[model samples]
Target: MANSEPGLADFTKHLRKWFETRQLSSETDYSEKLWIDIHTLFQVLAKGIDSTNPFSEAVCEPDNPAWTLRSHAAEFKVCQRIVNIFLFMDGLHYVNNGDWQQRYIFNNEQRLEEYLRCMLGHVALLQLYGDNCDHIELVRTVSNSMDPFREAFRHADISKTCANMNYRNIQIGTKLIGLTMARWMEQLKGTRHVGSITSDKPVQICNQGQGTNTKEATADGVRQNGHMPIVEMMEDGTTDVVKKLIKKGKDMTDEVKKRLIETVKDSTNPEKTMEDILDTVSKCTAPGNACVQSALESVHTSVTPVPPNPADHDPSAISASA
Candidate 1:
């Protein structure tokens, strides 16, 4: 834990430098140094998240000056998670620019789709941190900033219109971190003092996941089938949540499938047969449907949209596609 002391110090230092400098600057600065700074800052904060409690207060050193945004570990951690996603998706927007599109159009037409998926993942992760007012405020800010991206993604000709239109999307993303820090500063101005050298919040492991207590179950350090509770898992390197369903190698039997179809039929409109439901599902699952594509793209950035083949849409196509 003490090893994190220097890292935390470095984080606070760079954070102050980054915000104060950016606040004073008038122009949009996207230099290599700028990105390197962002990368370094995000790395440090992310590392701290693994070693420190995100929701805990960062106690400052007695003699050190106060830092605004570092008031809570979660503030910077949430910032890192959301901003990193924006930056990663920045490439898609950049490449979509009219000037670059001619020469660097995606091999497929799903780049915007992929970016939306990253946004969803960012939102989902934010939800896991619990809804503190600060977190709510952060989410609201992000939602407002992302409105344009969402609107652009839903356009009829999204691929043609979704170039982020003059770096607007990335600019919004850039301002988000600064805006978040500013809000924190304004809120804390006369209220309380923050510390530069801070102690991490104590970890509290308790009942979680389906609201069940696990303290007594693990009192003797016994393993529950060699698996720690999901609540104990850290976000770093946690890819299981993002895994693609197809890769799980699970299959649905025809009988079970028929039962599900019957259930759906019985529950809603009995007049609508299994074929009707399959038709609707198939259409939604089609790679070319804008709504379907938008959702799929928002979740899986790397997934290429397969071109629709006429032959693949036959009556049995539903089962075959599944």
Candidate 2:
């Protein structure tokens, strides 16, 4: 077995270390970019299947007799591999960010074994096609493209971490296409609204015209006047993580706002100096009032509050008083 070979084992170990270094480095944008490559690889395999469909008449044009063989190779090669690879990389990314060694991998020995077996089975299928389909160009290309990924899966041994995932309360499978498909669909949902407004926020109506429309009754009938269309407010867009962070800090935010407005308005001092105003405003907003007193006192003394002009008062106030 290749697993028993010391040379291959040493190479795999070095490869893992290299992967770890790249994963940990700030300069490397690996996960998302690698995912895109995985997507392209799946597309290549799918296109291969369609191009080499055995039952389709389209394959007759310069096609070989091994169309069915190539189709089978493409289908099996792409069916569960793409999702499993994504699950593997994403789960490893998740686990590597925290201390979940015992929980995700080491504790589940039997599951790990099953995961490895399934991955090896897929890799073996690839190797078989590579050896037997030398005459088929599409299979050759597919096999060559998948070779590195197949080796990564064979040597990484993180299948169990991916196989039994409880992401979003749904169990993922490494061998089946349905369950893994559902998993990615659910994961994609969290990012679906990125750079878009949230749907739950209610639309705000705005009046766009200068005056309100009026209806008048004429001698024969009632006439209605037309008004401008209402404009809607833009909704706030945010991610799930940003939403959680905002929710967690909401109470603190409200408390700080309340303290700030109260500090600004709570001044009852009869003195009309800038120091007096700053001192009052800083009492609740500043930490340890004694520390900021010198800074407050040194502030420009020329800026004083101007008395409210009586003419600027609303006409409703004068009418109410009368």
Candidate 3:
């Protein structure tokens, strides 16, 4: 129990206290406050779904902060669960999002869809199962609820939409749903902040995923014969990892930023421009990816609109005609 870690001890204590409070018989009947709050937060997040990140855009300051939209993604799940207790368990509020289709853009007839999805995600892994499924059943109670997951799995195009199932049809894919659940579990299990720091430098990325600067730190560590290399790299600006990656020729154009603008296309607001897309991506680079991507963004967004029922080109007919 390396509870000595900076934020670990507090989380264990918070979990113990939260679960213990839920176990009390009286606690069950007290109120559904948490659930209500989470639903409200989802409403807020829903607005930002039209943007790349709702919570961060709504909350975080957009200066040259050490963090970016990724930080908001990290915080979203944990905050949602806490909000859920207030909404459903406390009865201080109820779990609902109005006009699921109008809100979700798929089932204009289903208002509760987003609300249901949020609640489903939170409670899906609660192990309370049969006992805790009363609300879950409401989601299942939709005319097509029994096969909602399947319908979403078979019909919905997920990669182009929010993994949370926004902007697209209610058809979020099965794999997307599972991955979303896994992220929730990771949060509940509290796996993000666990690890030992071998270096003395100021390392920004705690979760070393796609866009991490690990190479230079490791090299510096080897040459200096200590973790100090890592620390120095992290603190003093030895982004040798970035240099190596650049040399290897991988475009670190902050793919997340590019994807962010792409998400706006399905929005009901207006079509996205390529310039805006490239502009957002440019913001991600240390010096900004201005020169390289300026034309690319313009060209990317310059796609010509086609009629919904455009005539299909028959390859065989064309070849025969030729």
Candidate 4:
């Protein structure tokens, strides 16, 4: 069955009516800092239905019990509704830059913080005692809704040193308890992490720390070994050369290829071997190929002579010779 619960709009209207009845104004500056009557609000929440109390009737059922031992689920829903009311108030205060007429609703920063912490404690208790998945889901939803209030309270002031200490303790205790309860639930459901087994291997428990250690070892080994073998280093180099040759081959125009072949055929040295032609082609195609350039220079020096140029002679001597 669909939940017939009151949504945010219903809660907002109810809260606004309550504020209006109490003559709370967002514009009022209560510098004297009168404490917001939180107990009165609780009493209003507890009150069931009456023609005189329209807000209560609109927000909750006619016979709704605020604190009930009969049904934990019912009580949890009540608490959730209450928390939502506070969340709405907090949002209003935030959006208006703390200028809401209901700003006086919280007597001071400390009061507001205490109120938020109290609600958080209530929600945590509900979560601890929750019986079913639906109850747990409601608890989670309420917790999420109240997160902003908790964050705001974190930065709020505490008037007394002891109050501040107690607040911090409460916050820590609630977190630890929530986590412990969740872990207990996981274990109860047998949903906690378990080791895995493969066909050939024994059961191996997955450990994040172990994985991290393995990664560290690999990184440290690489750092310690400054260089790899020449052959291993040249693996990527050879791959790059093949890729570059393929790309150049694809992009080489038919005209360009013909011109290269003609140049090779018209070589001055008739005895120039196929190897020499290939070396020259490599150098011409890839001027940045260091290996090809070195090889060609070595071959040229070994096979070819350095011819004397007449231009290298003194100009006057060349003229007289002529």
Provide C-alpha RMSD values for all models, in order.
Answer: 22.2, 28.0, 22.6, 34.4
lDDT by residue for model 1 over 109-133, one digit each (tens)?
2433333223322323322332233
Q: Of 2 and 4, which scores higher on lDDT?
A: 4
The TM-score values for the models, in the order shown, are 0.26, 0.18, 0.21, 0.21
The candidate that wins on TM-score is 1
TM-score of 2: 0.18
lDDT of 2 by residue, 102-172 (tens): 12222223343333323332322222121121212232233233334436444343432222221111111
Q: Judge candidate 2 against the unseen true structure and give its global Cα lDDT, from 0 to 1.
A: 0.27
After superposition, which runs of candidate 1 have C-alpha atoms over 4 Å from their true positions?
1-70, 88-106, 111-119, 122-132, 145-322
Candidate 2 wrongly placed segments (more than 4 Å): 1-28, 53-322
Clashing pairs in 2: none
**In terms of lDDT, which candidate is strongest?**
4
The CA lDDT at 284 in model 4 is 54
Task: Report the lDDT of model 4 for residue 21.
Answer: 41
Q: Which ten-residue region of model 3 has the weakest summed lDDT?
A: 313-322
Stronger candidate by TM-score (1 vs 2): 1
- Give the least accurate 10-residue stretch of model 4, judged by summed lDDT: 313-322
